[model samples]
Target chain A: MIEVRGISKRYGNLQAVDNLSITIEKGHIFGLLGPNGAGKSTTISMMCGLINPDQGQVLLNGNAPGIKETKHKIGLIPQSIALYEELTALDNLSFFADLYNLPASQKAERMEWSLAFVGLQDRAKDAVQDFSGGMKRRLNLAASLLHDPEFIFMDEPTAGVDPQSRNKLFESVFELKALGKTIIYTTHYMEEAEKLCDRVGVVDKGQLLALGTVDELIEQYGGESRVHIKSEQGEESFMTANPVNDLMTRLKGLTTVENLSLQRPNLETVFLNLTGKQLRD
Target chain B: MMKAVVALMKKDLKLLFKDKMAVFFTFIFPLLFAFFFGSIFSSSGGSQGLKIAVSDRDQTEKSQAFIGQLKEASEFRVTETDEANAKKLVRTGKQVAFIILPEGFGENYGGIFSGQPPEILVGIDPARKAEAGYLEGSLMKLGIKRFELAFSDANEMIKQLDFSIEDIQQSDDMPAEWKSLLGDYLPKFKELTELEIAKQPEGSDSSGLSFGSDGDNPMMPLKITKEEITVQKTGPRNSFSITIPQGVIWAIMGCVIGFAISLVREKTLGTLDRLAIAPISRTQILAGKALGCFAAQAMVVTLLFTIAYFMLGVRFDLIKLVLAVLAAGICFVGFMMFFASITKTEQSVAGMTNAFLIIMGMIGGAMIPLFAMPGWMQSISHISPVKWAILAFEGAIWRDFTYIEMMTPLTILTAIGVVTFFIGTRMLKLKQS
Candidate 1:
């Protein structure tokens, strides 16, 4: 279990993370969604204990995030490559495993298991310098898992990764969740959040704007989805505010409208409608 | 805590080995310096030769003898030249000294020995003053010998004059035998003086009276020898050997600079932030980093030792040599750690550390030997870590100190390392803000 309360972080005069509160139960994937510079990374950094919140406290199972005894209970995967590039995959895994205070006798086993989990067992002997971007990302993820922590904080874990690698990351997150682990995942990709998160928190300008399931958010801000019709020769044109029933009636009435499509707003539209801004910038 | 420390050490080792340029600079370059410096320092031409010039003014048997003495000295090269040429040669740095013998030098003491000091002017170039001084001393000794022989011959000539007994007894200042001789020889002396004065009619008044007024006969047969002996010192004792060892100190300083870069790299790559979140205290992380750096530098020092032994013959007892190297390692590691904690960027760290190393080398005896430096400068060198490190190494090798004799330098080195380590760790702890 992870709990953050009234967390606020100030970088000089700018509030990077405003006073906010959230809780993540065990065995669930919680998504932290935001646009660029929305304090998503700041909040995750605080959760990972890499930064001290100016006016709040974070607890891991009722203990401080980085308390000596509680440190082994959580794992952190940063946005950047954190493993030593010169070290082989096996070497990198073994080092992180040792950091968890794993016994010497168990380190080899843990390293092998972690590498196998990331599907990098064959490339374990090769240096990380030779690994592809996705492979390195997988290895970075594996480094965090070596300690087998109960809860993990991942900051844009799929950013810049290939689709295949991203899918693998999602599968791994689910696998960890299935094993009764808790995950706090931060990302700008709405589809990833919609697919993986049991619940999502939408943050912007260092403040939480909304928090609920994808369906719940759609119901709150969702309006009548419409379909548009157009003709090449300007013979006919039409707009249907209620697309479900009106689509068939309009198509039946307008035989000249050759190109017609329904526009059910995706997450990008949902974000724009709610915030009156593009999701990307 | 121990686990995290090990993890940090392992990570640093991995990164260092991965960097080919870093490996080359930290390990290979120092060996090159050691071989190069050692070969020059241990060369056989410690004090090879000296340049000397001989001014043969008298052109007599005695002058030829003095020139021959200079020529026979293998260490000195005697050049035959006159006073004008000798002075120009010494001034132009072609010769270290010139021996000048004045005119009529051999004839001034033909009869009675009157201790008329033969003045041989030895002109020495100030740049080669010591070498010239050595030659001057040798020439003075030879001149004395020749003058004594001339005096002996003059004594025999006085005996042959044979003065009247009444005139010799009547001379108040004359001893009994010399009085009898002077009384008998007064007319001969007067005749001899007149003849000696007549030989120089143009300037006889000035020359003869100067001799006569000093109670000395100018007719004495004396041999004047002139030899311009210039001594020029040559070999590794010259400028090159002195200047390059100072460069070796800078090379050692480069090791510290390299380690500081490692810290900056850690910061840039976000490894430092990652380590901070691990279950380790800041002090432990700093300790791990410093120890890893010390180990790397110590390995380099060992490589330098081997190179010096095989190529430069820098001899030392293995135990004492290792001890001295250990002391240097401690000081360098501490210095780099402290430097790294204060600096934020790789460029800053590199620039600052290199400048610091050079400054330390300059202040320390590594760049300038303490004996050659001014008093205040020597006192200021004590604060530089390289000063203690160089002193420790030279003490063991050049001073031939036993292990017990190395207490001061070793203690000072350890103390500095400890204090720097403490301060650096404190800085690291405050970095979380």
Candidate 2:
């Protein structure tokens, strides 16, 4: 388990990550969702030991984040495609594997497994610059696994990837979770978080506004499901607690209805309600 | 720790070479720079002419006069010493060469018609044997002027005539009849020389006897015999030998700039964050960067010097040259680190590296020869590692540096490397904090 206790970070006069805290369990996919300038990257950086927090501390399994043993146990997949573009996928993995100081007997095996896990086994010999955006993202993901890190911090892994590549990345995240590896995924896309996160944290202005399971947060902050009826005369919408049962009763009185649909509260509605719809820098 | 550092270094080198322009600048550009500048400096002796030592065994009026003429001429920088120390100066590479006038040089200063001409003995450093030819040519020019004066001066004319007559009388090589006739006619010529002197008013016009008004031949020539000797190994035989080092420094600075920019690139591109999060300490990351730069610089130095040895007729002491390259590599790596530390972006680094290196090269004699710079600039050049690097190279290659002499540049360069490295790493840590 990884625990961040009241961690805060400041840059100049700006509080990039305010006094905030979150705990992630072992073998869980925890999603962190925030708008731009919401301190997601800063929080992740502090948790991964890339930067020090101005206050409080982070502990990886009851030890400091950057301790010799603790650091080797965790891995970071930075938001950017951090793999070396000039090198082949295999070479990139080989380099990271060396940095991890993997045992000689297991080095090649782990390299092969990491590439295979990303579905890039055959493309290992190709330069990363030649890889598509999705392939690059996948390769980026593979680079972090050479040491078989227990805790993986992936920040905005699917920001600009196509739907197909995003699916591959999601599949890989699922596989990692199945293998009982803890994952902290940060993203701007609410749907990606909705699909991948076992528990999601919505933050704004360096503060966690809401935190719960996907359905639980939605039910709490996502108000009023609605049903829309399009009739020959006009269109109408009715608010209800239960759209399925209420729409059935309302539709029986509508003889001229041409189309009917139920609108249910979801994560986006919950997110907007908790963080507001204001634009962020 | 070593494994992580090595991995980082290998990765850096791979990426650096993968960029074609970086390879070109790192390996090829310096050679072109050296060649172009070498061509310019090859024929030039700089603001100062070639330094030469002179010893007059004849302490007579004409010898004094000849030495005076040498001092006035701009072609040779004259250093007058006794014959006892002339060879020592040349052997120790103090002066380019030394010229010695024999005991009878004054009496036989110029006697084209009076038999053997006065001889000037030249001792030149063997490593710089080509300079002997230059010294000889310069001496001949000074000799011709004295030869003209010898014929116009009445006393010099009488002396030459008498010496010729005495030579005929003493000659066993001359036939009896020819000897008698020449011996008889030489005195009459001597009488005419005195009468001609009587016709002249004073020392205002000392123009020598003229056969014709222009381009006339009144033969009075000085014989120059060159002897090459030195303790130094083969050195700069030509201009290219000197310029090869100039070229090498450009490439070295190029590597420095290239690596510095890459360091900033890592930060800007977010790669540094990944490395920072790794288990290895910050020291190892910096070491890896330094090693990558050193490797690039070493490859460049080796390839360039090998080309110089085979293609440019340059020779050097291998041990000293290795020391020089190592010191230079360390020094420039510090420059690389310092550059990386000061800048935050690729554009800024590129600008800083170019401006900084160009200034160092200018003042250091890497672009302009130190001999060509003003005295003030030369004095300032000591602060530039570029100058020290070149100085170390010169000591190892052509300068015939004693072990003690080699220590100056090597020590200074190493010191610069260590100091700058500390500052650079310290700055990095401060920024991280």
Candidate 3:
């Protein structure tokens, strides 16, 4: 539901995003994988109309980003928890709901559903300042969904959240996908992208290095699955260039193999192979 | 657009009310300052009655009469004393000044028309220049009245004889010897000339001028009379009344600084950015913030004035007072927005806002009355928005200003609000870009 075409952004002498292009279908979860300073947030900012790209354009369902109609259909959950600490959870939700121009009659019902969806319904009357970090993260997510925008952009929504809250957030993301909502997710963690995203794009140095599904990416850049074996003699690990069934059958005949396991190429290996394991700012 | 603006305004107000410290500074602190300063500065509610010692060494009826006149003066609190004590009182600052009449003063006073009159000894405190000047003026006026009373008939005779001598000099039938005699008397005629001259007759020639010694034709034709008329008969202004508007200015300034800091905090916390990303225009966001700050300022000012009205006996023209409060609120809201536009962080905005408020308060007569400052400082006071605010408020309160008179300050305040708001919004747009 979003199209980023030849978009490039620069900050002073540093090019933040260089000629980046990406497209997502209406009901898919697209994960943008990148290291720090990889221009992932910059691209998301351009798509949400928060920051204008230095060159090219961002179109949401054929309309430019920040066009009134397009902005009404997009929601952004920033990396930081952007809820008003001084205001109660309900007040914050009500404010964002009003900003989206939601009808007065629908605001309360929608707010109730959003609070329940994020498991913050019990503390809706409490000030957000007194909330736990995880609770605030959930409230931030809930605040974004107040108007139920069709396209949601989440930038590391679970960065500091507890594991339980992280699981809850993941479940919420999957539920949004099941409801046919398009989401653009960016994170430092590769496992989340592998578990939730329908298509993954690996970006580095302001450039897109690879874009594909889990299997497609693994086949293209991840090479082959490896077999690891441990025995009384010594531990041995090797890449199985053949099919996993043949490799397993060949390993079963070895008398020295006391332990056996088949490894599969995942999104992390694919991401590392394509973007390289290098430190970035 | 208005809906979004209203939502933003609601959020701001909510945040402000939730902050207890903000509420206290915005409303309570200024009133406390007003009460403290007001108690110290309130006048005694009447003219400053000057204390003076009077010593009548002459012991004559004329001297006694002069002393009585000084006692009868409502502005002076006169005490009869000996010359030694009078001098001692003035020296010790127990009295503003003292009047001492010498023994031969009444005897030599009648020589004013022919020779110099004896001087009256006035032992005065140099530090009390205003009181000393008043005392001197009072004595001079009394001396003139006594002079006029003592020589009324003699002065009239001198004026008539002088007029006759002038007519004789100009006559064609007069002999040269008589003309020379008139020339010899000319210098003495000038000595007899009165301090005041009446307008001459419309058609009378100089040679035929009338020189009759009429009772009404005195040497000094013009009479000088002192009459005092007060334009505003309101109660005497005490420190409380004067400080009421000043207190209101402080409240408005506090609101401005508080909200300006809040805006910077929101920007730093990413709340402002989140709002910007919504389906709302930049104008809506700014308008919302301005409206919120304006409302808070107006509420604080109103609360302060209400307390002042009941507790301090401050009077007001209800409608004009409301308008003045609104104008001040708008002006400070514009100031808040302007400060927010220029500063990036909460610390920077807070520092600048405090400095600006204190400087404006000091110069604008909020901390001290403008009239008490030097002439140059008073002139510079007009450049402050706080000065215009205080002026507008005073117009509604004790100044008894009419609607037309009130318009000058009100218009100035409104203009400041408008111009600052425009510039602030433009700067904000540029910053955003």
Candidate 2 is scored at a TM of 0.76
Candidate 2 error regions (>4 Å): A278-281, B36-235
Quality class of the docking in candidate 1, CAPRI style: medium
Query: What is the Cα-based TM-score of model 3?
Result: 0.75
The C-alpha interface RMSD of every prediction is: 1.8, 1.2, 1.1
The best candidate in terms of DockQ: 1
- Write down the RMSD of all candidates, one decimal each: 8.9, 13.0, 9.5
Candidate 2 structure lDDT: 0.85
Score candidate 1 by DockQ: 0.54
Instruction: Evaluate residue A146 in candidate 1 and report its C-alpha lDDT on the 0 to 100 scale.
Output: 79
Clash list (residue pairs), candidate 2: B152-B208
Quote the positional error of residue B62 for candidate 2 in Å.
25
Instruction: Provide a comma-separated list of chain B TM-scores, one per candidate.
Output: 0.72, 0.61, 0.66
lDDT per residue as tens, model 1, B1-433:
6667767676776677788887776666655655455456557446554676668677776557667876876667778887799889988888877777666454332223332445566777567667866776666666555545533333333332432333345456667776555555566665654454455557323322323345444443453568988966432333323333343455557667877888877788766766666677667778778867776666666666665566555555677767877777777777888899899999999999988877887789765565578999989998888777777776655666667789788889888887887787678677765
Clashes of each: 26, 1, 3
